[model samples]
Target: MNAKELHDKTPDQLREELSNLKKESFNLRFQQATGQLENPAQIKIARRAAARVKTVLNQKAAAAAATE
Candidate 1:
């Protein structure tokens, strides 16, 4: 998912997306630990995606706070 898509989602949807990304990241780490990970780059990609979602979420929160 891209930042544009994330930015369009409501906070609840963004939270759900973040949760799924975290689960994927955890599973990737477990696979790497067992030496069964075929693509180590996936871990990095997932981490970044999670970070992107977080950045969008924070931006949304800041915008809301500024309006209040």
Candidate 2:
């Protein structure tokens, strides 16, 4: 997922996405530890996606604070 896409989602949606990404990241790490991971790159992708969602969520929170 991209930052732009994440920015378009509501905070609740972003939180859900972040949670899912984290779960996937954890699973990927487990797979890697067991040496059964097919694509190790996915771990990095999921991490970055979670970060993007977080960034967007922070931005939204900041914007809301500013408006208030």
Candidate 3:
């Protein structure tokens, strides 16, 4: 959801969330292709959510590397 929320989650949880988002995105694309999509905006939302999770994950990795 938000950066603060994502930052509070463990890496494993973040990965799970990212995986779910990707699945949702794929489903949305399929629906769109078949002209059955209810909301086209959902595709964009899912993409941005995935990107946010990725950004937080990268930040955590970078911080861990710095500490090491």
Candidate 4:
């Protein structure tokens, strides 16, 4: 998903997405180890997507904490 779509998702949803992405990343790694992975660059893209979700989640948490 794109940054705009990621930003629009609720925190809980973002967390869920992050978890799923991590799982996918793990699977991708396994595929690579077995020499079955196609488009190895997908690993990097998945990692970046997870990072984006995390960054947004962190920003939201910080904002919430600041308000209280």
Tell me the spans in candidate 2 whose CA falls farther than 4 Å from its real position. none
lDDT of 2 by residue, 10-63 (tens): 999999999999999999999999999999899999999888888999999999
Kindly provide the TM-score of model 1 when superposed on the true structure, using C-alpha atoms.
0.97
Writing each residue's lDDT as its tens digit, candidate 4 over 1-68 gives 88889888899999999999999999999999999998999999999998989999998899889999
- Give the local distance difference test score of model 1: 0.96
Cα lDDT computed for each candidate against the true fold: 0.96, 0.92, 0.98, 0.93
The regions of model 4 sitting more than 4 angstroms off are none
Candidate with better TM-score, 2 vs 4: 2
Best by TM-score: 3
| CA RMSD of all predictions | 0.5, 0.6, 0.4, 0.7
Q: Which stretches of candidate 1 lie over 4 Å from their true place?
A: none
List clash counts for every candidate, in order: 0, 0, 0, 0
Check candidate 1 and list the clashing pairs.
none
Expressed as tens digits, the lDDT of each residue in 1-68 for candidate 3 is 88999999999999999999999999999999999999999999999999999999999999999999
Give each model a TM-score: 0.97, 0.96, 0.98, 0.94
Q: Which residue pairs overlap in candidate 2's backbone?
A: none
Answer with 3 or 4, whichever has the higher lDDT: 3
